[model samples]
Structure formats: structure tokens, C-alpha cells
Target: MSTSNGMRPETPETPDHESWWSRIGTLGQALTALTGLIVTVVPILVATGLPGQDSGNSNFSPTVVPTTSQPYTSPPSTTPPPQAEGINLTVSDQLTDGAEEEVIVITLEGSRVATLHATREQPVVSQRVTATRAGNYSYVVDAVMRWYDETGTEQVTNATGRGSVSIDDGTRLDVYVHEETDGISLSLESATQ
Candidate 1:
């Protein structure tokens, strides 16, 4: 008489195969380590101040872009051949000195009538445009400057001023623009200043 055994006899492990229990244990350990790493690194990333994280009450100021257009148009004169009409306008840039990266665009619309491109070092005067009518023409001068700030964002600033110039024969309408800490300032050559 012999005792009955339900299980089969054990055999040698396969040459290139891992044990199933051992593989499962290793995978579980690796998953746990990955979870631990994420837990450790996430706090560091947040605390060290990653970009695009807003606290809801941010003081960042939005950029300001300036636009220019001539709203007032004078009618062409029906004067005789002996009479001609037009205003001579000139723009002088007196901003900061030698700012190579700064791009300054000056737009003259209305009376003076010329768009001038200038920089800190170079000032430009536009060609004289013949006036269609003879009167005190009101014009708008807009100086827009663009530059790259330290944060790698393109920063734009604008200076604007309105002037009225009277022209009959050869009116040398001159305007000056300057950059100040508060903003831009403009002056007319005929101004009392």
C-alpha cells in the first residue's frame, strides 16, 4: 500500500526564462520606485518657480500696440496755375542715444503728412507733401518703439502728440519727439516752450 500525492515532481528552471514570481516582484518594485521619483521631483519643480504658473493675482502688464491713421483729409484746391497749396513737414527724433536694438517708427498724419523711420542715433525727416488747402491743419504724430526686453518678450511703447500748423508758402513744420522715463513727449517748434 502507497500514499496518494496530488502534485507532480519539480523540474530544473529553463535556461533563458525568468521565474514568473520573480519577474512580477521586480516589476512591482520598479513601479514603486517610479512613483517615489515623481513624488520627489514634482514638489521641487513647483517650488523652484516653473513658468506659466499663475497664482490668480498677477501684476504682469499687458503689452500696448500703437496704431496710426489720418482721419482728416483736406480737399484739393481749385486755385489757379499761379497758386499752389501744400505743407512742408519735418520730424526730428531725439530719443535715447545709440540704442541699436530699438526700432522707432514715427507716423505723421493730418497736417505734417509724412511717415518717418528713425532710431536713437539717427533722426529722419520726411519729404515735403504739397498741402491741398491752406489753413491750420491739425496733425497727429505717433512714435512707436519696439525692442526685446530681458524676458525675451517684444516690448512696444508709443508716444503721441497733436499739433496744428499754418502753411501758406513754405511752412517748415517741424516736430520733435523725445523719450522720457514716464513715457514719450512731443513738442512743436512753434510752441511757446
Candidate 2:
């Protein structure tokens, strides 16, 4: 439209620079959306597996085939650690005078494991007692010694001894009995392993 003087007045031209700037903003938004889509879709495709992918390959499967993080190892030892078998116990006596009906009772952990009987002929007794674990073990010994008096009459005497034996694998415990001044007594002679 012309002004009253019949001269065409200037009209502001639409800024081409603003159009360029808006185009750039639109391009940036498009790029951001595309990047977000790639980030979201790639993980899903890798996890659930892509369509038409090879099922024969274990790497492509959704069900995780455990790769041995460590090399093949023998199954954890089924057999337990070695345990002690038993203890060998021997009871020996030194008696000069002839005796009759000699009896020795051996108690382990308050349980009678052996009751050894010997006469003047044999004065030694031995047996194996089970002790599968390790620790201090207390035992008891009861002995009855019999001998003839000067009058040729039968006489009896009772003796007892208390001792502790440290038991391990292949342990041997020895106890001895001897005649004292008043009566008979018992003693722990030695312990060997």
C-alpha cells in the first residue's frame, strides 16, 4: 500500500537469520531424540536378543550360559580331613612274689573299655582304644593284686591310679603296677607317639 504522497513505504523484511536459527534448534532436538532412542533400544535388543538372530550360538541367547569364570576345578573334596584312628594302651606289672587272680580294669572317659585279667604266668596286657579326635583325656585304673602270705594263706590287696594321657594319632600309653611297702600301687610309666 502506498502512502498519501503516492510513495511506497518500506516494510521490514522477514529475518532470514531467525529462520536459520530456528532450523538449527529443530535439528538439535531431532538429534537428541534420535540419540535417546538408540540408547534405549540397543540394550533391550542385546538383552532380549534381536529378531532372527542365531539360536545355536550361546552368546546370543537370553538365557545366560554361564561361562566358567575360573578354569575347571575338581569338585570340593568329598572325603573329610584325616582323623586319628585309635590309641594303644598297655598295662604292665612288676611283681617278684608269685600272685594269683590279678585283675586290671581300664576306664576311658568314665567308660570301661577293657578288663584285663592275668595270673602269675602273664603280667602284661595291651589293647587298642578308639580316640578319633584330639584333646586331653583322663583315665582311671583299678587293679587287684593277690599273693600268698608267709603262712601260705591267700591275701588280696586293691590298688588304684589316676592319670591323664594326651591322645593323638598313633599314640601309645603305658601304665605300670608295683608292690609298695604297705600295699600295691599303680603308676603311669610312659606315653609314646
Candidate 3:
């Protein structure tokens, strides 16, 4: 039926429902964009020492490595399994149960080895550290205690201990950190393999 204004009968507008092919085309475009992003990111990650980078260089100096050993075949177990030559250390903190402590960081660095963190906790500090070489090693144990002064503003008391340990092939030593009236004392219990 025609209106008095001379307009034709109108049909209701239909909302557009995307078709399967059109959806697939959109998915293909997204996939292409994602592939391009991944392609661009991988080289950057490799260059920046990220996931895709190699653990070490193949052309490392021959003068550095005097001996050649076979690669490790299996995964490492819980206990420190004995290797041909290495030092395995177990550090135990003998501080009083309720002693004041905040951030504690213990490190051992020297002689055929880099730095190793023994403890980074409170109340108690215990950890297992393994090093591939055996020689004289120096350690730096640092800790901080936080407390409120008379004015109620937070204040910190820091403590540091320096010591040395001797290690040999396939040696295992237990280091005890004992708190004394003056400061912390580091003593070696014994050595074993």
C-alpha cells in the first residue's frame, strides 16, 4: 500500500550476520599479523639474551677450559649427587628462634667460582650450594634488622660478616651461622663427599 506522501511500502532492515568465509578471512588476517609479530620478536629476543638465545658461545677460548668433560645426560636429583670434582656446601643458620632479622643475603665468591647466594630469608636461613671447582672462597653475609625508635619512626640496624672457606675435589662442608653477643660467627662443621 502507498502512503499519501507518495512513498513506496518499505521492508524492515535486516542486521548483518557475518558469513563463515568472512570469519575465516578475518581469522587468516589475524594469524598473518600474529606471525609477523612473532617473526619480528624472535630475533630481538635472541639478540637480547632471552628465551631463544644460546646458553654459551661455541668459540669460547681454548685457553680457558683446560679439561674436557662429557655433557650431563640426565636431570639433576634432589640431593647433591657427587660429581668428579666439585664442592657441595650446606649452610645452616643457628640464630635464636625469635631473633630479630629482616633481609639477610649471604654470598660466596672467589677462586674458580662466581657468587652463590646461600640465604635470603628470615627466622632461619638454610640452603644448599654447589660449586664446580674447589679452592679458597670468600663470603659476605649481610643482614638488616628493622625496629621503631623512641619517636616511632622505623630504623634499621645492619650487620655484615666476612669469612673464608676451603674446598677440595668432591668435598662437602656444612657452614654454621651462629649469633653471638658481638656479631654473627661463621664456622665450618666438617667436610665430606
Candidate 4:
């Protein structure tokens, strides 16, 4: 392609097929853009749903579909029942007219066994205690008495008693608290096996 100056004339490349080729090139570019949009927007649309609607389930969400089901049964407990003998200890109050209220605390072998509240009308309380072994158990009783003085002021007195009793199987023991001439005294009244 030489001209008068011995150089090629300036002209468009592929001049004969430019019109059809450019349209096809444009269509290829459009297809590439549409493919890129699908690749980007389809995942986004699937991850987060449409603008106002709820997002669909996540791919990582776990769904459980049971194939076979049976009624659940609980396991049995392993603890055993107590097998030692016990004693039914009884407390009776013998306060005549000097006290309005009394609180008796009984402790067996340094551990609190029971606390008995005795009033004027009801002056008896009992509790059954289980012994791991058959022997004489030492007990301590602490008593508090409350009454009114002549001037309408309240009066208080405290007394304590210590004793030991033999407890056998199916034994019932009775202890009594009496208002003595000095103060109060706790004594084992009787025991029945």
C-alpha cells in the first residue's frame, strides 16, 4: 500500500468489516458485563434477600431431620436409702406460771438437732433423729425464757443442760424441762424401746 510519497495512506484498520465487527464486539462486551453482574449480584441476592424482605436461610445453618424417634426414658437414680436405726426424742415443758415464751435448742454431738418453741398453751415438741450407729450420744440443751416484770418491762433468763442418752433401734426417749426453784433443769424422764 504505497502512495505518491512512498508511504501508506492513513486509513482505518479492517475498513471493510468494521461496521459488523464493531457491533459484534459491542455485543461481546455487553455479554461480559452481564456475566460479571450475574457473578456479583446473584450471590449478594442469595445471601441477603430483596431490599424489604427477610433474608433466606444461611448456607451454614444446621437443620435436623429425625429419621427415627423414640420416647425418652430417664435414667434411674443411684443413691441408696438410709439403713441405720433412729430414735424418736420427745421434749415436754413443765413451766407452771413464770414464763410466757421459751425457746429450747438441742444439739447432739456438737450438731444442732432441733429447736423447740414452747408457749404457755402448747409446751411440748418432739423430733425423730436418725443415728448412724448405736451408741450413747451426748447432747446439750440451751433454753431461753421471756416474761414480763411487774412494771410491764420484759424479763429474760437463760439456762443450759448437758446429758447423754443411749439410743437403740426403735427407741423412744422422753426429756423434760421443768422450772426449778433456782432456774430450769433438763432431765431424761423415760425411755421405751
Candidate 5:
């Protein structure tokens, strides 16, 4: 059909392309202008808040609290005490009735020797020795043949079997035995330094 201006009638299959462009022309330009304004004004606002923006407020109140009362207190010192020169030894045994035994040994180096014994759920033996010189030295611990008698008496049967003391310096010592034994013989078992 023809219109008043003599243009042919538009149908669904023949859409008016000019009508689409005309609708978006002003809207697109306005959007572009709005985006430019936002970009420019936002950056200026951010810049105004940045450091050294103006010296008028350079001497503003300190952001940190000024201590009119408690000045900053220093933390307590964390220095360790000076260590002495000597060797200390500790031996712990994990003794289970018929099960496995685990031992722990610890040694500390120094100049004087000391012996200590402990009996907890398990038995423990220890020694500490002080070195005469500043050089390397070694110490020994002989595992004497021992057993708990049928009558529950603890007895040392042989003094020949030996187990070396694991040293932690000239002074510290620790030795551990992990094994299950009935006390018939002194087994090397497992010794850990």
C-alpha cells in the first residue's frame, strides 16, 4: 500500500533499516558522552584523594593514635641462656612384656661427666661426661648380661657383652634398644643413637 508521502508500505519480511538507525542515533551518542564523563570525573576524584594532592592538609592529624599516655613498650628480650661445656646422656627403653621394645637416646656435649638412672613404665639409663680437651673424644657403655630371674630378681650374669654409648658431644649421651627379649642373652637388638 502507498502512504501519504507515496512510500510503499513496510511489511514484516521487509523491515525498515533506517528506522532502527534513527532510534539508536541519539541514544548511542548520549551513552558515549556519559561514558567519557565518568572516565574523566572518576579519575579526577581519585586523584584528588591521592597523597601529595595538596599541602593544605599535609600536617593533618596523624592517622595513628598519638600516645599522650602509654609510649610504645618494647617486647621482652628473647635471648637464650649461655650453654655450659659438658656431655649429658640419656637412654630410654620401650619394654613390652613379650612384645617389641623401643629405645630412645639423647646426648648433649660438654666437659664434666654425670650418670643418671630412671625407671618409669620402662627402665632408663643415662650418663653425662665433661671433655678434658676441646677436641673429639668418645665414651663407652658396656651392656652387662642381665636378666629378670624367675623369682623376679634382677641379676647381671655377664659383664663381657657391651653396647657403646651413643654420644651427643663429649658430654651428652643417649642410646635406645628396640626388641623383645626373655633375658637369656644380651642381644644387639636394635640400637639407635
Candidate 6:
């Protein structure tokens, strides 16, 4: 009269598949604490607003725009063309008129001319002349007295005379003349533009 169902008495429970895995681990810890309280009250309700106040606001007003500019032009000027005139001559000393031949003639002003000759057995003579004209001009210097007076016929006049002129654009002018002892002196050192 005894028990023989594997010696009976042996019942420690918690089974039914551990109460269905303990109700699925308490429903995954209540859905991870409701997703961490909705990720910490949704940024504190978008940074304070519900009973935490100050939701940002400073009468906002800032906007300005306007700009335009364009206008200015000036440049054009040129001038040139005005110059042409020049004359030069020189003769200093030795143009005697004692016993014969002597002639010094220099005339310029578009008609340009130059001649010089001295003789009393060759006294002295020098000459240099040039000019074409471009504005104002007048020149004349004569010293003639070519003689043979004992009636062999032949005698010239202008024993001594002087004159001058200038105002050129063809460069410059330089004049010099000297033959004293009964006259003939003229000078106008230099002139240019």
C-alpha cells in the first residue's frame, strides 16, 4: 500500500513557458517607458510653451534694400597744327669800300636770297641764309659800292643800309651782321617756338 508514481511529492512551478516569458518581459518594459517619455516631453514641448512659458518673440522687424547708380562720360579733345616760319643770316666784319668791289646782300621772306663778296685785295665775306615763310617776315641788308670812278664807268650805290624781320614757325631764326665804319649793323640773336 504505498506510492510509486516516481515517489510522488515534487511540485515547484513557474512554468507554462515561464508565464509566457513573463508576459513578454512586461511588454518590453512598457515600450521602453513610452520611448523615454516621448524623448523627454518632445524638447520640453519645443522649448517651453506649455506651463513653462517664454516661447520666443521680440517684435521682429528688420529689412531694408534699395540701390542703383549709373551715369557719367566725357573725354575727347585734340589740337595741333600751327607752326612754319624761319630765316637766318650772318656776316661779321670785312666788307670794305675803300678802293673797290664790296657787296653784301641778304634778303629773305619767301624770296630768300644771299650774296656776299669783299675785295680790297680780298677783305672778308661770310653768309648763311634760309627761310620759306609761314607768318611775318621782312629782311634786307645791303652794302654795295663797287667802283671804278676815275671815269672808266661803273659805280654802285647803297654804301651801307640795314633792315630785319622775322616771326616764323618753320623752326627758328638767327641773324647777325656787322660792318662798321660808315654803317651796317643788325642782329636778332634767336627765335623759336
Query: Between the candidate structures 3 and 6, which one is better when assessed by lDDT?
Result: 3
| Candidate 5 Cα outliers beyond 4 Å, as residue runs | 1-112, 120-122, 125-128, 133-136, 143-146, 150-154, 160-172, 176-193
Please tell me which model should have the higher TM-score, number 1 or number 5.
1
Best by lDDT: 4
Which 10 consecutive positions of candidate 2 have the poorest summed lDDT? 87-96
Question: Per-residue lDDT tens digits of candidate 3, residues 1-193?
Answer: 7888989878986556665556679788789889999999988877666666574766656444334586545546687677665566665554433334455455668332222222225444556667767777777666555656677776666666677767664455454557789866554443553
In candidate 4, position 59 carries an lDDT of 60
lDDT (Cα, 0-100) at 97 in candidate 6: 43
Candidate 2: segments with Cα more than 4 A from true spot: 1-97, 178-182, 191-193
For each candidate in the order shown, give its overall lDDT on alpha carbons: 0.57, 0.70, 0.59, 0.71, 0.44, 0.57
Select the stronger candidate by lDDT from 4 and 6: 4
Question: Which candidate do you rate higher for TM-score, 2 or 6?
Answer: 2
Give the alpha carbon lDDT tens digit for every residue of 1-193 in model 2: 9999999998889877777557669788788889999999999888776899853556553544446886655558688787656544444444435777667787767887767777666656566666646667778888787889889998988888888767665666665766678766675544664
Q: Write the per-residue lDDT of candidate 5 for residues 1-193, one digit (tens) a residue.
A: 7999999987657456667556779888789889999998888777567565663556678455549688766669898987766543333333324322223222223222333333344454543344433443343323333446677777553211234333344333333333336433222222332
Worst 10 residues of 5 by lDDT: 99-108
| Residue pairs in collision within model 1 | 86-130, 86-131, 87-131
Cα-based RMSD of the predictions, in order?
22.6, 21.6, 16.3, 19.9, 18.3, 35.2
Question: In candidate 4, which residue ranges exceed 4 Å CA deviation?
Answer: 1-88, 91-96, 150-152, 178-183, 191-193
- Candidate 1 stretches greater than 4 Å from native: 1-112, 120-122, 147-155, 178-182, 190-193
Candidate 4 lDDT tens digits, 83-122: 6555445544544366788887877789887777778788
lDDT of 6 by residue, 93-134 (tens): 364444377666656543547676778777766655555554
All candidates: TM-score? 0.39, 0.47, 0.35, 0.46, 0.26, 0.25
Error of 1 at 179 (Å): 5.5
lDDT of 3: 0.59
Query: Considering lDDT, which of the candidate structures 1 and 5 is the better prediction for this target?
Result: 1
**Per-residue lDDT for 9-44 in model 1, tens only?**
667777666665566797887888899999999898
